[model samples]
Target: MRSAPLLLLLALTPPLLRAPEGNQTRIGPAWSDSRNPIVTTFSGKRLDLWSLRPLTKAPPKRSIDAFLGTTNARTTDKRSLARRLSFDLTGLPPTQSDLASFTTAAAYGDKLLGRRSYGEHQARLWLDVVRYSDSNGFDWDEFRPLAWRFRDYVVRSFNADKPYDRFITEQLAGDELVAGKPKTAADQDALLATSYLRLGPWDNSAGLFGEANRVRNALMNDLVETTGTAFLGLTMACARCHDHKTEPLAQKDFYRFRAFFEGVTFRDDLSLALASDQEPLKGLLVTDGDKPPATTHVLAGGDLNQPKEEVSFGFPTVLDPNPVALCKPVREKSTGRRLTLARWIVAKENPLTARVLVNRIWQQHFGEGLVATPGDFGYAGARPKNQALLDFLARYFRDSGWSVKKLHRLIVSSRAYQSTQSPRRLSAEQLRDAVLQTSGQLTERHGGPPIWPPLPDEVLKANPAFLDDNKEKTKSWYPSPPERLGVRSLYLVQKRTVAIPLMATFDLPDNAVSCSRRTTSTVAPQALTLLNNPFLTDASLVFAKRVEKSPEADKVAVAFVLALQRVPRLDERRLCEDLLKKHGIPALCRALFNLNEFVYLD
Candidate 1:
């Protein structure tokens, strides 16, 4: 039997060994050698890829404006600047009093950056990059109830002004940090931070042969891809199947990088003792399973079943040629691979991490980054139009104790950031929160579990998978109590299969992949949602009630200032008054909500 199979293999091999034709060389079998051909010598052009090169040092006192040569750029008026700063820092529109009392841009920027709302807003942006959701994604889409602990942790981290490098360490290796015994509330918070590993979509359903391995590989792949795009701004998933087509990343590099996470497994039974209240709450986190890690191999064509030559733990060879030494903890249940990886990521010698972070912050404030592609720093992505400015920002970020608030202050104080620019639409969360704040309906509670706001009957009916059917009486989707409906949009439950209708209309990103920059689309549904959605209608009614006691002329002025952050002109006030008399204050409120000035930031 062995001889017969060997003869068959020999007969099949000859076809691949055929004589060379023309200038083409003969090719070998598909799996002849599992190892990819390594190219150690990169050309000068390849070495000069902007993001991959070492960071260029700058003088200690150089300002952001000096690098951009934008010192002559004109600043916007105080009211517009106040509104912009409020939305940029806190994701909320300025109050009438806030606009009235606005002083210098720097002072106002510092004030907003210090608020609790700043953390909530920044957490939402960071959550988008990590694909954080409250449920498993695929067909089953089961809920992950304790996931909000991680969300709250992120909010607290930002508000406390935790160093960016420390933030990276906690999310990547928080469980390892408490490997011996957790003694403090900070240690417990570290455990919650490990939930970052479990944020991606998962499939709970069983499948065919080798399905377990397949699901595990899918998860590992998501972790590696998310880590790359979220921290390094590289499209590493492109190298999983073969050598990356456009960049220097290789197939082996992908598997070796993934090997760092081979020991990780989910742990949901852990309890965190809350600092606010001494009660213990169940938490979702990741831990290294109590066993030696399985050896990882380069999968032929990225298939779990076609595993090839085994690879060891290491960073991407393109980023650093040295190998990492893993320290196995004798007293703990971990390989310590993740901690090593995390340290390397935030190390001063690493080129991509700081640059990627500052670029994302710039994108949030300016509607686009200096490098237009926030997540891709590969050969295929856009090169920074202002490399000197980007380098200066990156160096300053790392040197200033990796402080995000300091970075925000530095950037906002620049003429480049404060200058007048074309108007940009509010993000989904900002628009929703602004509507609630304008109507005086926004709940000011900080955090706990996510809340389920009311969804349209059609939307609920469409997503049958969102309901739990295992119980005797099938549990259907139910909105939270009426009081909680007014909470900020960040607290809304983020089900993978069912998006809140209004948010979906305004382009809430699908939570299945890392989203560095959200796509802004102009469509009929956006207008229709604002005009016809019951949430907006109810908000308008509440807003009308707030201003109905005032005189008609005063009502128009108050409404305009509240919604648009500026006083209404004579022509606008006259038109609004006519609408107010004919259709009532609610009608005028509804019309204000639909205005370009109300929903857009200038």
Candidate 2:
């Protein structure tokens, strides 16, 4: 029988950030070349640009500057350039103030440097790869109020510019790396990082397998998929039932890889949750999803229900190019199988591991990857958009000991990363939230339980979910007590029952599995969210209040600083004064907060 959703919470993949991959592949959008080109920045599309675009089209500013320098007629169209640049930087539209800043800067050949008023700007791509879900997905999508812990963990990690190596080890073998046999608080946090293991859907409703073996296979699949994507850049799912059809991996290789985690179980969950009457609730009480003893068989149809030839566990041959004979553990019961498996997956000789993670880091900053498909690096997948560059960056990641933060600095500091945002705009979530923040409405509070913001009556009615966001009536996604409404989006309680419509429109997944990329969709529903969503309305008003909340030592200046994180220019000041004069302070503040300038970064 399926466990309670709470129990599943202790089990399931991290929430997926999501993407338009499946659709994007079918529709085939051109590889965007909006970024500035620097030798230091290696998005493969640079060389592919002319081939993809009309040759007659004018070149990007960075391209013009590179060829002819500023002295040449590297003329840029202002309106298009500003809109394009703003969208790229902040994920929002432009406002009068934004135009003012950009025009002033543009005149001096500095405007396209990118905007500084990013509202919740940067988006992390790896979360989807890891398959992050706040709620534990099971028979009934249950609410995990504290799943936000992991969500916040990821956001904070990105915000802090956490190093990649430590991040990986902590999640992969966090419990293994702990100092003592008994994990400590620090050790547990690291171990909990492996909560990455418990993510995925389990079809245990039939109660078919021996209790222990099902958990074992479920956990093993997690370990394998996670390793394949996070490191090797392969989709081990190809190897699950048979030899990989296209990739060099053979069916035996899949089993061999499975051999490593053959003995793992849901009970091995490293991040066991604790409970209390404390101010902020912690994780749901849980045990490591450790498995019990079981046999390894080549399920005739890869079906646990079917009996076939019995097979001893071993590593996949595709990974083992040299081919080592497989061995089972000495323990009569379950093998400490995953321990050995994790060892081999992270081994240096394995070519794909380091490359995959490095590619991910690159994808995070540039909005694209050396290998556009982060999880699938096989024959069916697109070749590395730039193989040489992918290899170079991979080697750098491996040689540098997987320092993610170092890579970020290396990237962001580059003129390429710091280049203007153009052509494409940021996602709607970024727009709304960032606008609120830039308008001086972003809440500074960090961790604790997730809170429910208001929900749409139509959405609720359409879905027929009786759950109340304000109460635990049916485990609302953000059912935090009224007092705790200010938690980060990461802190919002997760329920697979129904996603926030705007978020779903932005391609927030069902949280059923780890998703590597979230798709960017331009739809009218999003416009509706901006225009009428209670959350957006509240954010605008809250931002307005925050700007005016302080005593008047230059209320407008304080407002601008809080909203835009910068002082208001004369033009902006005049605009605000006119707005206040026309509609009064509250209306003007509300209007300014709605401007694209307040939300976008560039």
* Model number with the top lDDT: 1
lDDT of 2 at 41: 29
Per model, state how many residue pairs clash: 0, 52
TM-score of each: 0.91, 0.67
Q: Could you tell me the lDDT of residue 360 within candidate 2?
A: 69
lDDT of each: 0.82, 0.50
Clashes of 1: 0
Clashes by residue pair, model 1: none
Q: Estimate the overall C-alpha local distance difference test score of candidate 2.
A: 0.50
